[model samples]
Target: MTVALVTGATQGLGLALVEGLAQRLDPTDTVYLTGRDMNRVMTAVESMPGGGAEVRGELLDVADHQAAQRLAQQIRERHGGIDIVFGNAVMRVGPDDDPRVIADQYTEVNNFGTTRLLRAFAPLLRDNGRLLVVASSLGTLHHLAPVLHDRFTTPSSLDEIDEQIARWRDELKDRRTGAWPAFVNIPSKIGQVAAVRVLAAERREDDLHRGILIASVCPGMINTPTSALWWNVSTAPTPAQAAVALLDLALDPVKPEHHGELVRFGEVVPFS
Candidate 1:
């Protein structure tokens, strides 16, 4: 039986994917639908239709490296190996108005926390297992160039972004100026690209054990709680819609051929 583990599954895209996966997973497969909220996550799981895959809600804060590691061990103990893992939790780190603090917070979770998830569970991902990083079109730099130069920078490594953060902290002694925290938030394109690049780089070898496929997906500007403000102003896809795209990668029969590709909707969107 193939089991699945998803972090940040309480609501928005996470919950949407869990709901979709619940319907898609076989009856024997187990799924760890997780998020930071215990009650809310449990409620979302129970409320969703067809808990066929041993649906269970786990209160997980992936930002906590120890907790993420422990969770992986628990999954390993319970299922022996995982068939699929969606490392998809991300957040802006601090108060939006305060860019310096905001940059710090975004860098911590969106970048470091994501790596933590991969580090904890990469070993247990079964051979031929697929790993999907729910990245953002916002993270697609080349697409948002020329017009978005003022708002977004070219893609770079999380380490690069972190270095900038460190520099911003030193330069901006005053948190009131605002852009200090914002500068550390790596452009969305960088976040999406870096996730796949880092994942593949970390696990390039070991093809013999089982072919693990990693892809950075730009799910487009989906209408989630975080992007609700864009609801009326911009055309946004639903989480359910985005879930469909993600499911394609998660359940693909041929992974190695598609690994490390940046995909959007149903197409293989190219990137640096």
Candidate 2:
């Protein structure tokens, strides 16, 4: 039986992802939808249409490392391994938000959270499995200053990524924002993509032998509570529409060229 998991699946793009998976996966396939709130998670699962994949709501806070580990272990015990994982949990902060809060929230929920999920579930991916981290077009290399490109594109180790985040935090403390991207989300998403690249590199042998694909995806602009926090979404695609591309990426067979790259609509986006 196919087993899949979507983080932050209670609402918006995440919720849409679970719904899409439900519609597409077979009845015997199982999909775990996770959120920080158990009530909301169950509610979302109950709201899904019947006669699709077996949907289960799970209480998961991607920012909580132990919580992620426990859930991964539970899934491993029950299902042997997961076939798909969509890293959809994220935090969005704007200029009006406190810099201190922004630094902490964005790093904890967006950047490191992606790292936590990868660490927790990556090894449990079955052969020919797929893992897609839902990043954004805003994470493009052009969004960052030239000097920072090499650091993100070179695929640093997870510990090195942590150090880079620490360095960013220090820069924020010193009020040296000029060296970083204008918005914290850019660097945060970049870190997510970088982490994916690192995992892909670390698992090169697995990619060749097992046909596993791990990459970050940009879902494009969508009308979601998260995007509404930043810009006008009146004309943006609905969450369901955006979820189409993401689900396509997650369900498609491994494409050797696309592994480790940041992709949108089946195309590789330049990292630098």
Which one wins on TM-score? 2
The TM-score that candidate 1 achieves is 0.80
Q: What is the C-alpha lDDT profile of model 1 across 1-109, one tens digit per residue?
A: 9888788887777888887777888788888898877888889888888855778888778767587888888888887988888877877333245544455565556
Q: How many residue pairs clash in each candidate?
A: 10, 0
Query: What TM-score does candidate 2 reach?
Result: 0.95
Candidate 2: which stretches are off by over 4 Å? none
Report the lDDT tens digits of candidate 2 across residue range 84-172.
99999987665578876567766888878888899998899999899899997777778888988876765468777767777787687
lDDT of 2: 0.86
For each candidate, the alpha-carbon lDDT, in order, equals 0.67, 0.86
Indicate which candidate wins on lDDT.
Answer: 2
